[model samples]
Target: MNKTNSFRKTIIIASLIFGMLFGAGNLIFPVHLGQLAGKNWLAASSGFLISSGLLPLMALIAISITHSHGIFELAKPIGKKYALIFLVLTHATLGPLFATPRTATVPYTIGIAPLLPGNMQKVGLLIFSAIFFGIVFFLSATEAKITDLIGKILNPVFLLLLFLIFFLAFSNPMGAAKDAAFTASYAHNAFTNGFLEGYNTMDCLAALAFGITVITSICSLGFKREKDVAITTVKSGMFGIFAIAIIYVCLIWLGATSLHDFKLSSNGGTALAQISHHYLGTAGDALIAALTTITCITTVMGLVVAFAQDFHKRFPKISYKTFLAINCLLSFIIANMGLDTIISWSTPVLMLLYPLAISLVILGILSPLYKNDPVVYKITTALTLIPALFDMINTLPEVLRSTPLIQAILSYAERYLPMFHLGFSWLTFSLAGLIIGLIIHFVKQFNYSAVED
Candidate 1:
């Protein structure tokens, strides 16, 4: 009886963690991708999965493997100051500089925008957001009894609402798919675009940040062992992703089918909300709006907690309460800008961050395989950053472009790397770095002396 109860409890804990990772952005983006990708949804989705699914799961695995404080501490092999820079960069990626504010704006766009009178929509958004962020401020200000209950209840309610919504879309698709937006290049181009798109979802970054929380939750339930904790986290992640996978397929297909009736949407958010309002009617729009807001709030809360926790670690003098207050104020401000803009700027940041993120996971996985050597971390990270920097530069606006270095690197990447012409521009360049590092590691190892000879 005792053993059976323990196993059941473990399952529940695992499921909740999975749910936490699968929130607002997760729902919004993939469905939108489906609409654009159409019959090509599968290929595009596979691209989405690389960042959305694989990269994040791997980040958690890296956390478990290192059992370190965060990405900053984990990268101590490099040096402390360098690690802090990585930490600041990651927090900025997830928070005020980009994603954090978007969290607030996204739900507003999806949930509230449709119901308003055409001329009043913008005004309604501004008013609605002020109230929304105020609530975030209050709930975040003090983790009260009500907040705990609300958090627990959100998962089940959100799931129920989503299940109901998707059911409607699947049983009665808006219409058949119209035409692929970028057909010839859609399949191959998808992975890179998907990779870039993954940033907007923000899970890969969140995975590293939230890994400790997952481990702690598992431990609270009386389990220990980093390896076991990691296994559990991965298992839960897979379960959540099971939901993500199904949802993405249906939503993208819905988006594609929507096109026969509607023109090509500017992007996913428009396509999703427009399709929902069209098929599901006024009530459906309201339901989506409410649900999107709920999901986004929870994610925003998670990021808040993470930021506060980091601050507490570095400055013990300032209590968690102080940090929470500060975070809420900042997030409230960021959230007001609206979701559309937040997502726009996140792309270039992803080009900068994704390679380093992939590097951490790859390095962590290969750490044991290589005996956690200083040289491997140093060399591989250096090589990986080169192309990542190049890719970031290649992706920027012309006036925003710095010097000729970016142009020089882009020309070189095109010449040497595979798929460069096809638009795996980012990953192709990274591959060049990966290859160079591996070759150097092998060649250098053999030259080391086995004896004093």
Candidate 2:
């Protein structure tokens, strides 16, 4: 019972968690928030932090606390078959469908797109990703020092360069904040926009998948006990939030200031690149590109490694090498898809998957506190998932609303739920409904399960 061990473990685990949470997408969301939030930066930042800062970190803490092996374990309390469905959906989300594809797309947009022609952009993405995952496969092949290279050296370097941009922005504001895009609804809308922007970050959902890797990394540093791992992850994760929040605040500020000088760019990368060009001159854009490419590469490496590791576990007969090859190939195909298409197509899937992902994250950290109750997990998941469906349908207004089944669900949600038009209102209702459902579900269970037969 060395209390000191827990403290030491927390620092180690958190440093590792920080590395996981801070990645390529961090560069994207804050800039957009700053642009759209314009004069309403604080209100928008509030919403941004809830989804970007607090929710994902909460989810990570939950994952470590519950000892979920993957997304599947957190969902397993509902039923094995249902958990499998959740597993496939979560895997597809972080894999080729959205997140994995974005790794290739975002870097190209920020790092290469401005330099290339419209027709050449897709070719650039395909080529960059091919090389990107190839390097990931090579680095992941060895489990020893290279992981440190990525988790430690390369990542810190990425943060440092980004921090320099933040520092410059801080010393000199880029421009004045403009009127927010939807000013009439800006106050309430900020939160919903923040929630959706959080999706673009994609780390929270990825956190669930990477949660166990974090636990193992903690144990490897020599904190073996489960209690120690929990304490360590929570503490370390808090430290990470502090560091990331600083960067987020800086980027948002940069975005807000830019409106003083120019109309907001249609794409977020444009806003970010503009900031770089103004502050540092011609070379700064290239400097930003170099850092971004590095960030994207490291993330792809980590994700592919995590995915391969999980696949091998499910099929023990297949060696890790084989799984690694399979992962790289799948990622390569998915990456070749044009950048604009990935960004456009990902919205529906991201909306559909987020609440479910959010639920797993919350359930994991809270599980240890709850004695891993199957009834509690089952009830809460069911409650949370209902609104996520609506969120998904609403993302595709023309296609989804036009469909019969979706029209039915959209009708039901709109008719019954107030503020349904507000972005992510469904997330709020579903989470609220879950809390309420759990209270009733657990009390009923206590009466029936706890009463002596």
Candidate 3:
């Protein structure tokens, strides 16, 4: 391909990456973090960028370096059974159980729910989600060019609307971001708090699933070699993530400045609505609602299709359409629990899954060093899993966390694990696991070579 054509294709791929990963959680989390971090927004956003921005790019590179077809293949070195379990859990979290459902709830919470009376909000959500998923189902069932639809059409429109909001906010400032007061959680450990808050975006998890689509797109554009594909992925991924990181900073700054007029919101959706209304009134609200819904539709369709296709491949007896319907139906049911409830429940799950996912990403990236050995994969993942479970238990809702069994587990973790209170106890365990696994791998290699001599 010519340089001009190659550059165009690369840009298109970058847009696709941005469209796929920047969905409901991406819209809300940074704004909410800004509100919490207040004057410390810069410190907090740096941490947020690591997990929400850099990690997703790393995930794509991991898939490319390993040449894994999808999430299952990415985890395959751990063992087939473990790969299957990880695949199911990752898809479940990304699909009906959490992320997909949140797609429906976030737009409703931001734009639609505020217009309704208190009692009508629940019914409004039910009606809105039904229509939302109905559209998703129709689009996914068709053999449409979803990648082009999102990258060429919807993402640009969403960006235009979002940029308008940002421009207006910056032009007519609510207050200086540095002048905003920090919430108690962010007062002392804003960076750590922001790091954990980044988990809410779920982009890291989505990156693993979306990696195949990106790689395939690059290959179709005449990049036949593995090295070329990996390089292209890195180029496109950097562009996509750089865009996302910029938006995250802007949204966080918007949130911090909005504190001049509005109090801390219960969630980012609420904060976004308040800001929109303050600047543009009903029109701003409508624009934000449309922007959110458009971004979310792209995401929900992607998640549903990915889930159905993967599950159908695993169980050939089930049709893809059948799996699609099941996912949509389950997501519709869960979305009605409302945005706050979904977020509250999803946190513990993210806490549990992130460490495992991060470990896998690191392992995949470093697989070249270990020669993709199963022994290393098994050891690192096994050690990571233990602390991950504790992280989950520790993050559970207060009511469930107060139970005797859960309390006992948290007490033990807090006492025994470093950085347990900061929600990074897994870091120590994962490092230890990797060291031990590498030592064992080298020792085994040495023994076999000696015997051969």
Candidate 4:
């Protein structure tokens, strides 16, 4: 009986993790990558998996290994002020600012809009998003049952529908993959493009923010000890990562083979809908709609619950229910801004924030190598900030993108920063900072040991 309970708990937590990560990006991005990659689909999928798969798993593992209470704990080595800032920024990014809103917008665009008549599309979206976020608000307002609600109920329904679609697609493929030319970026460097594409999902950022929630869920499941919580977190995260990897590869395969019959699409969501319509007709369409809606709902609920809990802890007077209501309200308003606009505007923020989040995760994992020295964390994060800020500037809107100052900065970075053109200028700076940090750490250790002797 105890073994059975533990097994069930593992499955529940894993499903919850998968639901958190598998938003519209999981459903759409791999398919789009496969389409653009053409014959190089495998290479592209590998890159995508590295970013979307390995990076997120690493972030979760870092959380578990470090036993971080949350993003605040994860960033505390940098300092209290910076930790608060990082936590706020991460929460905002994963909450009302982008991820949560995108959940509502993505489903409306891909699932509902296509079904609506041209004249009714706008109204349809408003109605659909209203209902979507309404459900999110309802589910998240009461946080006690959230883990079970997502893991036991919503996730299984989502998986069943998703597996059905995948089975149909794989069993009777849309068509064979033809010798089509790769898209412009994919033609030269499909892998890197695919790698960066995963950033848009922002799952790594979500993982950092969700760390506390996962720990709480584990504790609620009777794993009260810190060590047990960490161990369970890693084990549960593995199940989610495994599910993501399988689904992504299959979706990419579906997209790659789709080129034989369907035209290349602007985004993965559209490609998925089109393919579904072609293969299963109305039933396929219903499946896609249900999948999008459920996936988006799960994501929104996860973020809403996380954000509410974090804020309520920080500001005890606010109450979790109020925080949940505020976030849902904000998400609903932003989501109604339309999917394309939200996505376009999100690019700059994602560019800037991704490096910082990645740097923290890497530092957390490597902290043991440097003996968990705060100096290492501080310097490495500072160095990472420079290139990430410049990258952010470069991704600005056209009006600000071509100014002389911005162009000059970009030019200078391109000339001196390794991998600047490939969107990893942070890599060179991080390594330099890590080395400097190690030197400082070892010198301090040596001096201390000599004095003791």
Candidate 5:
């Protein structure tokens, strides 16, 4: 490998990863955590790094090492039928069902909604999402050009504007890093709360989906071997991780320290708006609007391309353009549900999908130890689904929640399952399944050796 060429390819691939990973939610979630975590912001953000920064990085590495064509391939150890179901559900969640729509909503909520008159807010969002996703759809239609469009062009513009905002906010300071009162949610186990909060960004889930795109970009740059692809992916990911970490820390500090001089808003968007106004006035606000819009567009483009490419390959009857069109349209309609509605509805689904996604990634990393056994994957995932199902039901509305059947199941889980109250019941069951799987594997091996003798 030519050192100079490899370095250049790494920068571009890294920018592409950063662009895919850094969406509007990335902007909002950290700031919100900082504000809520208050004086404990440092502790809380340390937890946030686990889910947001670390897990996503690991997912990227796992995908590249597995040489997964997409999420389906990454999950193939679980068996074909299960892999298809996982791929469909994961892509749906990452695309129209949740993350994709949020891309349009976040920019509008933070950047555009505040600018519109109160009466026009609803109409403003509709028009904005339509136009926002329209541009995303157009860009994503030509999926092959994604690396250049995002990595070389759009990401540079976004970073320049973001850094300017960061510089201004730091130079003036929002207020002293005040000892803020912890919110009820973060009042206890603030670190864990922050860790959970990072889940809302869904970066770990998206990283797996986006990994195919990263691997393709690397191969395009001439890294053809599986080992080279994995190595280069990690090196490229370091660039994106550094950028995300610096930005997240800055945003969290901004939120944590803003309470002394600025009243906290209902959400991260409002808080960001107030801070921008305080520092840069209308000009600063405009810059924010531009930064958020660009970031969201790039993210949406990545998502649309990822979903379309994977689904199109799976179902050759449907063209990539057809799926891209469908995803873009669905995302536009869902996004118009408004930011609050989208967040509320998407939260439960995310809670359910996250544990499963994390389990698969971890299993993939540990595959070597188990010799990539299908039995291990099946047992672990099957066991995880029990608690994961209950977790989803717990997020349902009062009408469904009031059902005796639901209550009975939840009560049983809470009583029998360790860490149920803390939202990690799946961990216990998953571990048990792993142990069972190992025993079965070893016992079967012993029997086979005896037959051979």
Candidate 6:
């Protein structure tokens, strides 16, 4: 392709990536982080960007470098059984269990729920989600032009609307971000809190799930060589993630500054609603509603389609449409639990899955060094698994967490694990695992070479 054509194609791919990754959590979490981090928003944003922005970009690059077809293949070095388990868990989290459901509830929470009478909020969510998923099901079942639909059309509109909000917020300030008071959680370890908060975006997880589609999209654009595809993937992914990072910074800033006029919100969704209304009044509410709905629909459609297609491939006996129906129905049911409940429940799952996902991304990227050895993958994953389980147990619901068994386990972890209170006890374990795995792989390699000589 010529320079102009290549640039155009890169822009198109970048838009597709941005649309796929920038969904419910992407919109909400950073804003909430800003509210909590307050004067520490800049420091918090650095950690948030590392997890949410940098990790996702690395994941895409990892997928391209490994030349894996999907998450299953990206994880295959860990062994087939482990790969299958990881696949199921990853998809389940991204599908009906959390992300897909959040798509419906987030838009409802930010848009429609506020409009309804207090008692009517429950029924309103029910009606709105039903309608929302109905549309998702129909579009996914039909296998519509989802890429073009989102990239060429909806994403641009969403960005325009979002930037308008940003423009207004900056032009007519709610308050200065530096002067905003820090919340209790952020008062101590704001960066760590922000790092943990980035898990809410789930973009790292989504990058693995969505990586193949992005590669395939690049291939379809006439990039025949693997080298060319990887290069384009990096180029396009950088553009996309850079855009997302900017938005995250803006949203976090918005959250911090809004503290001048409003108290800290329960969640980012509420903060966003308040900010939008503050800037634009009733029209702002409508603008936010439209923006969220557009973004959410694009997201849910991608999730449902991905789930059905992946599951149908795994079980040929079941049809894609049947899986599609199952996903939408389940998501609709879960979404009615309300946004806060969904977020609360998702924390434990993300806690468990993120270490695995991050390790996998790192492993894939470094596979070239280890020559894709299974022993390394196995040992690293096994050690990481122990700390991940502990993290999940620690983050469980208050009732379950307060139980004797759970409390005892948590107490042990806190005493023994570094950074236990900071929600990153997994970092030390994961690093140790990686180093030990590499040492084992090299020792085995040295022994074999010596014997051969």
Model 6: pairs clashing at backbone N, Cα or C within 3 Å: none
- What's the count of clashing pairs in each model shown? 5, 6, 0, 0, 0, 0
Better of 1 and 4 by lDDT: 4
Write the residue-wise lDDT of candidate 3 on 101-175 in tens digits.
999999998888878999998889999999999999988785346667777998899999999999899899999
Clashing pairs in 3: none
How big is the positional error of residue 92 in model 1, measured in Å on the Cα after superposition? 1.3
Off by over 4 Å in 1: 1-3, 115-126, 141-151, 176-188, 397-449
| Backbone clashes (count) for model 3 | 0
Question: What is the per-residue lDDT of model 1 for residues 284-329, given as tens digits with 9 covering 90 to 100?
Answer: 7787787787777767766666766676776789997787767666
Predicted structure 5: lDDT: 0.85
Question: Candidate 4 — which pairs collide?
Answer: none
- The lDDT for every candidate, in the order shown, is 0.68, 0.72, 0.89, 0.85, 0.85, 0.89
Where in model 5 is the C-alpha error above 4 Å?
397-405
Model 5 agreement with the true structure over 1-453: per-residue lDDT tens digits: 889988989988989999998989999888888889887888888888888998888888777666676789988988888889988988999899889999988888888877789999989999989888888888888778899999989999998988887888788885665577567777777888888888988999889898778887889889988888888898988888778988888989989888877766778887877777788889978987998899988888888898988888899999999999999999888888888888887777877888888888888877777778889888988998888887777776667778999899889978887887777788888888888887887788889999999
**Candidate 6 regions off by >4 Å?**
142-144
Q: Ten consecutive residues with minimal summed lDDT in candidate 5? A: 174-183
lDDT of 4 by residue, 68-165 (tens): 87888888999999998888888888888888898988878887887778999778878877788888888887777889888888888998888888
Q: Using lDDT as the measure, which candidate wins? A: 3
Q: After TM-score superposition, what is the CA distance of residue 79 in candidate 6 from its true location, in Å?
A: 1.1
lDDT of 2 by residue, 418-448 (tens): 6667755555666675577568667876888
At residue 61, give the lDDT of candidate 1.
Answer: 70
| lDDT, model 2 | 0.72
Query: What root-mean-square deviation over C-alphas does model 4 reach?
Result: 1.6
